[model samples]
Target: MDTAISPELATKAERDDLLTLGVEEEYLLVDAVEPRAAEAVDAVFAEVPGELRDGVQHEYYRTQIEVASPPQLELDELAAALLRLRSGVAAAAERAGVRLVAVGTAPATGQNARIVDNERYHRMRQRFGDLSPGQGMCGTHVHVSIPDPETGVRVLNHLRPWLPVLQAATANSPLFGGRDTGYASWRSMMWERWPTVGPTPYLRSHEHYLTLIGDLEASGAMLDAGMLYWYARLSATYPTVEIRMGDVMPTADDAVLLAALARALVGTLLHEVRAGIEAPDVEHPLLMAAHWRAAHDGLEGLNIDMATREPRPAWRLLRQLFDYVRPELERHGDLATVTALMGRLHEHGTGAARQRAMLASGASVGDVVDELARATRGEPGNPPID
Candidate 1:
């Protein structure tokens, strides 16, 4: 698509410490009895404090709600802020006779469920019909702010190969449609039917991105730039690269770990680009293959090397990648927490693994929903919410 950035922009002197972080989490609003997204965010919003309420917004379906953390330099603080916001939202939902559950996809969603009736959502429904129905998927979005558009594009390009590893680490959806989907991350496969919703094509520059967006706009393939729902893409609105890979984490600790890894990777890639080293280019075809593996097997999948196009066990590749980015995580002060949780994720398995184990042992979807609710609330028995 000829997305090369101009030479002048690429050659400009790099800025120092060009990365900041933020997070966006989507949640399902469930009726206390059933684990499904509830159409009650508008009512719940009124109960949250104004200061803690600004960035909270509705999702494609009224049944889902989203909260965004303020931009922060400290990863731990960012995680805490998100947890606080989540707690507030949950409490408000409870007061309104609804509850909040954090998971990639709700177990009880169906085609008969209602979509948010806003102009934008209605337009999308009109355009895509049942393809864009209320799927009740929840996700955690990590934002790494770059110094400029060129750097954003560069970091986005370089990080494409490692996304599947991160996805495997955070795999949390083992059930969908009130039964086992038989995929580690059912959410990963669920969103692929949209026009531009998977791993994006590699772009060389900001201009290249502009051209692609321009083409999508000109061709009416998308309503505007906002509809280009790539799994990992450079944000046109915020000056950040958004990694929409992970599921809605099962616990706050898992969420923090995902954020730490993402920020470290972005920081390291930016450092490498500034040092005039060529960023590693993973084969796009291999990345697509690995993504499918991550969706099906989660941590158990055999990940293919993007450069060599050779298969390796997901655990082995994840550990190798962690070693390479460990320095960056250390420098950012997230090393200990990130490393600890990486081990925990491996030992306990991703959310998908945990959910599958729970179900196989006789827990129903309602039980899974209750567990997710407790995890989100930072209850005593559960791991601390991030």
Candidate 2:
């Protein structure tokens, strides 16, 4: 628990605008009756108001819808925006005769997801068939402000191992194809099927980043620069570094906690760069292995140690992760919320754990969606998670 940051950064004038952040979450639209995936995203969009219509968009699957929050300085402001987005989307979906559920994957699976009628989506399904149909998954993405691409590259390089910690913290997909997958986040495994996905190969410089992405696009494996699905990347459309590793957390409060950690990680990495601290030289394969362990095990099992790149208890890795960002979190006045979230992590476990616990108590897959749908709109749920 060192709250110490680089003295060089301490002396620099603090900018009120340094910590801007935004969150994007995708959700599955399900039939209200049997809790099966439903292809009603267009109908729901029609019900949305013209003012908030632009913020919601169609996903790869017609059953999936995405909502994005405007950039906000404080975590509370971001949470408020997300709540409104979720409620609006949920109300629209309800009116459209489908329920909006925010689990990482559809609980009552086995049916193929209907593909949206878009040219880009058509190409994706044509190129990657089975993967596209089973891709009825959702994830919570956070974007933290980075001054420029140079700093973004540095932050991404420093963020490799810790990305798994984010995975461990937000594991939510436990059921796939209507059966227990025995993995915390099956959505993470589904994402790996894409050609240009997973850990970026430590692009140390902005020039290096372009070369890496350029080679992938040239190879025809990825159709465009946007298809390079690194868990973390410099945003193509914004002055921010995007963390795309987490599943859609069950509640808006949980999503805000993930966003706060993302901002703290960015701030800490920027300060590390200023302090002349180099990112650890863990190989890309090792980094991929770490991500696998985290996605498979979540907080209830072992995680790869960032310093040594070896197996260790998940709690140990999680603790070390917080210590690295404690300084940045304190500076942003987010330490209290993060600390309380850690407590909830232990009590309620991850969303994946809660899903399984409900099943263990004889709740069916449909019942799991019932619990998830309620929590999706920031409503109170059983076991009373904070």
Please provide TM-scores, in order, for all candidate models, with all chains considered together.
0.91, 0.94
- Which regions of candidate 2 fall more than 4 Å away from where they truly are? 1-14, 384-386
* Clashes found in each candidate (C-alpha, N, C closer than 3 A): 5, 0
Tens-digit lDDT track of model 1 for 1-386: 11122234333313334356778888888888887666787788777777677658788877788888776666677768877888888898888888888888877655545787789888878877777455577888888877788888888778888888788877778787788888888877877777777776788788998899999878766788888877688877677789997788877777887888888888888888898777676666777788888888888677776667788888888888888788888776777887788888877777887777777777778888887787777664433222
- Model 2, 85-167: lDDT tens per residue? 99889989899998888888877755787799999988877776776556388998898878779978988888887898888
Report the error of model 2 at residue 21, Å.
0.8
After superposition of all CA atoms, the RMSD between model 1 and the true structure is: 5.4
Compute the lDDT for candidate 2. Answer: 0.83
Clash-forming residue pairs, model 1: 3-208, 5-205, 29-38, 252-385, 252-386
**Alpha-carbon runs more than 4 Å astray in model 1:** 1-18, 109-111, 382-386
Clash count in backbone of candidate 1:
5
* Residue 284 lDDT, candidate 1, scale 0-100: 64
Reference-based lDDT, each prediction: 0.77, 0.83
**Model 2: lDDT of residue 265:** 87
